[model samples]
Target: MGHDEPPQHQVVANDLRRRITNGEWEVGAKLPSRARLATEYRVGANVLQKAQERLIIEGLLEGRAGSGTYVAAPRERRRMVRARHREQRGGSPFRGDMAEIGRSGTWEAHSEARTPAPDGIALRLGIDTGELCVRTEYEFLADNQPAQLSVSWEPMSITGETPIVLPEMGPLAGLGVVERMRSIGMEVTTCVEVPRPSRASQAQANLLGIGLGDPVLVIERTYYTGEGRAVETADITVPDARWEVAYEFGIDA
Candidate 1:
């Protein structure tokens, strides 16, 4: 192969991508069968399969398990903004986040007994490995459609025996992290966020309705107390096919 030449699969994917983007194939329209497409492109079925897989990862195509491949509908790109000042006002971040994206949101959260923190989670929350911590899993929905998923951890050393320990089983139930910590006299003052793009894990893909290996945005966030102690940390997942994560600040009053 010439150094300047692109891979055959990539070349096929580009041609298909162009057709989809150009509206040659309207959204939700089925593409030619693999055998037919391979013959049309003068490539083997294996090569064409690889090409369609690229489009699938790019959100330009979707393959239904038994229904063959089709052009994907244009997804609504919901903006996910992280403006510190807005959150300082104190409320459910999930609710506000969805509203900003022009959708009504609800979530189902399940909290579990305090358990030994995993090494990665402990490091993020600034706790020792095997230390007791409260874990909560959340599935956030916009208009009843799954939009995001998260898993959060808070060290039991800080919340143990407190009314806020369960996170969703007290007077402070459903309150945001900053507010919940405040109710227990821990003043949460700063939050740090690190964002990265990664292939969707099977669990995430199942919940978000995207194929495995599709792009998704993962946010690792930690809230700190006034004394710089990490109070809580969470891994937030949003399917990139359906949301556009953005950082907003400096709003004029």
Candidate 2:
């Protein structure tokens, strides 16, 4: 198409995007069929399809591999980090920690264990054949919207005896495993933090009140206890709209 022709697909995408972003079509609203959109925009079906793809990339829409596309809802954001390190090591400063969030909002917890753990989770927990890690999940809400989805793993050796590491047990009970172990006389000497790009799953969408396949920020942290023994690992999913994280650096000079 010539510059004067206007990018037909882009024009179609922008109109739909504006509607979705402006909440004209609420989240989960089914978009018009390709033929319908093409007819309305006076463009070809292929052009309409390309327009839908653009909205999907912008996180304004969700498309099933085979199903249709739908308007995407907003998601709350979350920030997670080790409280002690942030406080003592002069890292990023935060207004709150897990405790503060837990106290201020509604949250739920689920825990269970199953043999033959799921793929990489099994290896990370160091469970040999026939063994499984005790997994606990927390869905935290802020101002009534799902703010964070977090999953923590503990070897059978630790959580098995308790069935759960309940919050009532104290901060460590609900804290990152490293701090918990330290409170129990096992010092946490090492940790690993990994973050990568990922899309929100249906479960996460349900919790965050967003349409399926929304974007999410994923953080994975592993903690080591006394003598460098791997103690626990946690996978945290944060919705970008409501969450943010910061890191601070100091100059020795």
Candidate 3:
């Protein structure tokens, strides 16, 4: 093989993908057995398996417990828009986003109060490591299907004595960051997000119902007050196969 040539498994995966795109396999069509495919491709069973697994992670195929792998029906990739207006609007922005696409959005959240901040989280929130913070984990759903996951942290020094201490269990429960902060006389004026691509961990895959190592988009989002104080920071995960993120910007006139 040439030094610049793709890996054998990757070449096989590409061919399989091309064939699928060309309608060689219909949705829900079971693939030939690994042994047969390996023989046809002139590769080992391991290599063929790897190739199929690659497509599985891309949402082109699914493996059943007892049955063999089959082509998956194409999933509708919803658009998730990130913009300042989303925060400015009251209520759950996630729900609004889903409503725009005719899907109902709901979330399950668990909050732990007085949790010690790890070094990374502490730095993000501009708090000292080991300091107390309220942590909330969220699993967002659209049409009762898992859509996004987020782990959020807020410094105790900022919200410990407030009614909105627990994000989802207070007078301001279910409100967006902007309104919640406003309730405490803090005006949130800035939102910053850094998005990066990642692979799903086992836990993430189980929750999102995707293959392990599937592609995902991780957004590090921080909400800040006019004084430049970060009140909340969250790591939001969106499965790449199920969602596409779009950012909207408004130019000052």
Candidate 4:
């Protein structure tokens, strides 16, 4: 066959896809390998490989590493179950600037800022009370509303040598104080998270656009070096009605 000719792999993939959709092969059923399909369809290995990839993308097949390709499980079709579905939400919800924050379906990256740490915050960065520290503040938003305010601190003595502390460093420069420190030779091996529910203070209430008596969510995180040295600490606040917290765990065997 000519190089310009329509490859036989595509033909085989289309046929298999049609059969699966037509209920000939149910979910979890195994499919033939590139070599076997090549023989059956009188096509080259390259063509068979191409066809398999197309089926995988179309959600008609699944490929597990070291395992052979198989018919894909039918996905649970979800409809507009609610008017305020996750996808309908906008930009970073935490900040008024971003319509939604966090991931559209799950989490989103809200507002992020890098500034000099204050005296009290310096202690959290493992620096002297008066030492220089970079403070990166993030407000996680959900569906374009404030979910949480996360403030991270890092000693300028550690990251000062890098441009990550610069004013116009741009977003995503130093995602979190821990990651930024790691980029400059400091490895954070431990993290401590503290969660609490309380009322938003006057300043916090202003930032969050909530009343003083309103219930709020607060989270504090501290990142530490390998030797139990605390490298950074964060204080976050979130309004209760605007944010939802989700956590999942998987144990390694």
Candidate 5:
């Protein structure tokens, strides 16, 4: 083909994609080698290789180290219901977050003591920029698969000397944000979230089993009490490929 013409690799890609979508090759079945396909398609080996790479990036194919490429198994898409946390309904923040979606979920968390609040965290928690705080990191799973991740911070001045000082330890272990605060005489009355799309970092990509730079959803949430004090703030992350966030609103007439 002339340089001015459309790339021969793309034509080969289209044909292969058609074969896959048409069920000519089932998932988990190895694909033909580049040289064989190149000869059969009357294209250069390099062109065939490029065509296969395209499918891999598109998530239609997978490449095993030292093993051949094969059709990728489909990934299941789950829903994350984003709504106002109603304490009256009762449960931990994560439990409530996943309630409307009807998915069975569990979480693993690590708590650190007396950590200095980062600049942005302090601003969100309404404390001085270098204030001491209790920090907790969580990895939430649904049906035994990684569903979401969150890192939460609470001002030490507020939680210090209280049983709920460490979010995932002491008396109120595993309690959601509101209940944990309420146990210490602080009533959480409001929750505000700012959500945006972000790219997956190397660590996040590894944990979420996705390629680096893949899109993920980021939500920044802050909880408040009846007296207007910021009690807790958290950064929540959800992988885009496996989850979708849905927002529901009720209009009052």
Candidate 6:
């Protein structure tokens, strides 16, 4: 194949996508067997399977064990806004984003206190490896469907011995990072975020109800005090198939 030519599986996937878009297969319509599709496309079964898998990841198809692949019903991709204004409003930013789109938002969180920070977490929090910190893992849901995942780390040096040590246990439970920190006399002023594309792990796939290796968006976020101290850091994951991330900023007058 030429250097610029698309891969064989991708070419097959493209044609299949076109056929699906043209309604060659209605929603929930079962596709032909892989052996037949392979023969029809004049490609090996592996290549055809790869193409079908790609479409499956794109939400155009779905596989059923012991059954067959079928056209998946179209899903509405919702917008997830990443804006500084959301944080300023306090409470759960995820909840507010869901409410804006008329979806009931809820989340399950588990916080562990005195958990030793790993190397990466320590680096993000500007603390030493194995340093004590409060670790919280969250599964955010929109209308009770898992929509996002996050693992957050907060250095114990700042919150240790304080009422806010356990993120979801104290009086500030469910109050966002900014408000929680403010209640303890910490003035959080700066928020930094770095977004990168990644694939879903088995655990992530189970939680997000997506196939393993499906595309996802991971955002590295850290909150800083005015004095430039890193108070909390987190990794937020959003499944690409069901959500589109949008960044918004206000222009200075």
Please give the ranking of all candidate structures by lDDT, highest first, separated by commas.
Answer: 6, 3, 1, 5, 2, 4
Give the worst 10-residue stretch by lDDT in candidate 6: 88-97
lDDT of 1 by residue, 28-132 (tens): 899889999899999999999999987876678889999999988766787777887656655788888777767897999999877899999988877789999
lDDT of 5 by residue, 167-217 (tens): 777777887888888888899898888999999998887676665798999
Which ranges in model 5 have alpha carbons more than 4 Å from their true place?
1-25, 28-73, 85-87
CA lDDT scores, all candidates in order: 0.87, 0.66, 0.91, 0.60, 0.84, 0.92
Leading candidate by lDDT? 6
For candidate 5, the TM-score is: 0.73
lDDT score of residue 137 within candidate 3 = 95
Q: How many backbone clashes can be found in candidate 6?
A: 0
Instruction: State the lDDT of candidate 6 residue by residue for 117-178, as single tens digits.
Output: 99998998889999999999999999987899999999999999789998888798888899
TM-score of each: 0.72, 0.57, 0.75, 0.49, 0.73, 0.75
Model 2 lDDT tens row, 46-104: 99998887776556787876778888665434555444455443211122454445534
Per-candidate count of clashing residue pairs (backbone under 3 Å)? 0, 3, 0, 19, 1, 0
Q: Evaluate residue 223 in candidate 3 and report its C-alpha lDDT on the 0 to 100 scale.
A: 91
Higher-scoring candidate on lDDT, 1 or 2: 1
- Residue pairs with backbone overlap in model 5: 92-176
Which of candidates 1 and 5 is the stronger one according to TM-score? 5
RMSD of each: 5.2, 8.7, 4.8, 18.6, 5.5, 5.3
Residue 116 displacement in candidate 5 (angstroms): 0.6
Better candidate number, 3 or 5, judged by TM-score: 3
